[model samples]
Target: MKIFRMKNCLLGSAFLLLLLLQFSCKSTYELGRKRAHGISDNRLYNQIVDSSLSYKSLWVKRFSAHYESNGKSQNVKGSIKILKDSIIMVQINAPTGILEVARIYITPDSVKIIDRLKKEYLTSDFFFLSEKLNMNVDFYTLQSILTNSIFQLRDLYERQRPFIRNFKGKAIGDKYVFLSDKAAKVERKLRKDKYSRLYRFNYQRFEIDPSLMKITDVIVREFGEEREMVLKYRDFVKLEEQKFPSELVFKVKDSIQSLSCKLKYNKLEIDEDLKFPFKVSNKFKRIYPD
Candidate 1:
């Protein structure tokens, strides 16, 4: 009788263990299935794209800037004007008066910077800027940055812009993370159907705010290097039924040095015909670099 009781007890224990295992597997499977389905639905992406700003022009009355590089910090005030999709003008001035310290003018094909203190001016293109900054960039990316909109990290406008749906987005916590690379399985499927290529989908990650449907952060991964460039946006304010981030931060770090810039927007006006004045003084030497 004792032996029979022992065998029965062991059998009951094993049965309970098997049941627990099955339940765990089923729960995990269900969760994964739901997640996959949600990503497939992709309503979040659509919402995000739709939330991007549509304006003919923008004029920023005042903005504060704080920059930190290698344990040093500085603060200044500035203003920006944008002729939407065409030109951007930025002016950095002294903290007290209207004495301009530096001015930058950017367009679809050109970039010009005037350094008041150094008494020089620089005329360059996006290619040189990319070489110095060590990232793939173009005019569209810069425009997106200033306007707090979503954009891809490559300079493939003439060839083909990236299709955001090529990659997948996953909801984590309160935000959605969209990466710019397709999975092996998805790649195979697309290629099998002769789908258009993803236009050089590099390793990039964009974090979007679910409530505001704006991109809060963008991370770019450099090939053959373990470094990342991060651009973060926050402190959004709504105007005319649209949201814009009033505060934005950019950071880049490597083994040797680190850099950070924080910008605060004080005022914004949209659809205003703005002036972009850029005059190169004769005293300032010209530097057109390749």
Candidate 2:
């Protein structure tokens, strides 16, 4: 009888422990969600946002790049030239040392890529890239991503008003963190009686060192039905009192395959009068989606 009573007491204690664990998990999650709710300093948040957006270079910016993607890697040089809200030109050099392999020109309304290896060219509107990446891809978005600058829903060149009014912020230890407002989630019926929901994640999130007003990392992600793209920035360098990433890693996953690219900059030049040259031969073939 004593053994039986002891077994019952042990079972009861185990059940009580499980309840406490569940309660503790719930409390942690709730506290995390409420962490940013107490943020009332609008000025500090705005300063953080502006610090990223204000990185528009006055003249031209160029960098030598090492790019790798799709199980295949290459050592190539690249350059970026942005004329503010007007135009952005990206050029990639071939490993042969003298040949230019690819060049891309992005304007407000169109995107053009010239490939010398394939002897082909691509021309499309922003919708082509937007659909390819499963997210909104535009001129400003590309420029901001390439330059490691802050981005918004609309291009900074296109809008006159501010679009960062809804950032959530909090102070954790010594760092100030900010995240974009959560996008609307989509729901769909998977099986006959079951439904599933997917959330639209942030286009980008910025973590800044408040004292220096410098961004430490930027994370960008977008999720679709079965595909997603993630890009992370790290290893920042101080350039003329501004911060820029020396390394960038990008990944994309889909039902069919996954692709990734790592870019490491070897040389960074500012205010240089750079050249944008792109020419496609008529003998080259153009590639299109099947």
In candidate 1, residue 88 scores what lDDT? Answer: 73
Worst 10 residues of 1 by lDDT: 18-27
Over the full model, what C-alpha lDDT does candidate 2 score relative to the true structure? Answer: 0.48
| Model 2 residue 42 distance off true place after TM-score fit, in angstroms | 2.8
lDDT of 1 at 172: 78
In candidate 2, position 138 carries an lDDT of 71
lDDT digits (tens) for residues 53-98 of candidate 2: 3433323223333333344444444445556676666655545545
TM-score between model 1 and native:
0.73
Q: Where is model 2 more than 4 Å wrong at Cα?
A: 1-41, 53-72, 132-134, 153-162, 183-195, 199-204, 220-227, 279-290
TM-scores of the candidates are 0.73, 0.65
Q: Which residue pairs show collisions in model 2?
A: none
Candidate 1 stretches greater than 4 Å from native: 1-42, 155-161, 182-202, 288-290
Cα RMSD for candidates in order: 21.0, 18.5
Q: lDDT of model 1 at residue 56?
A: 90
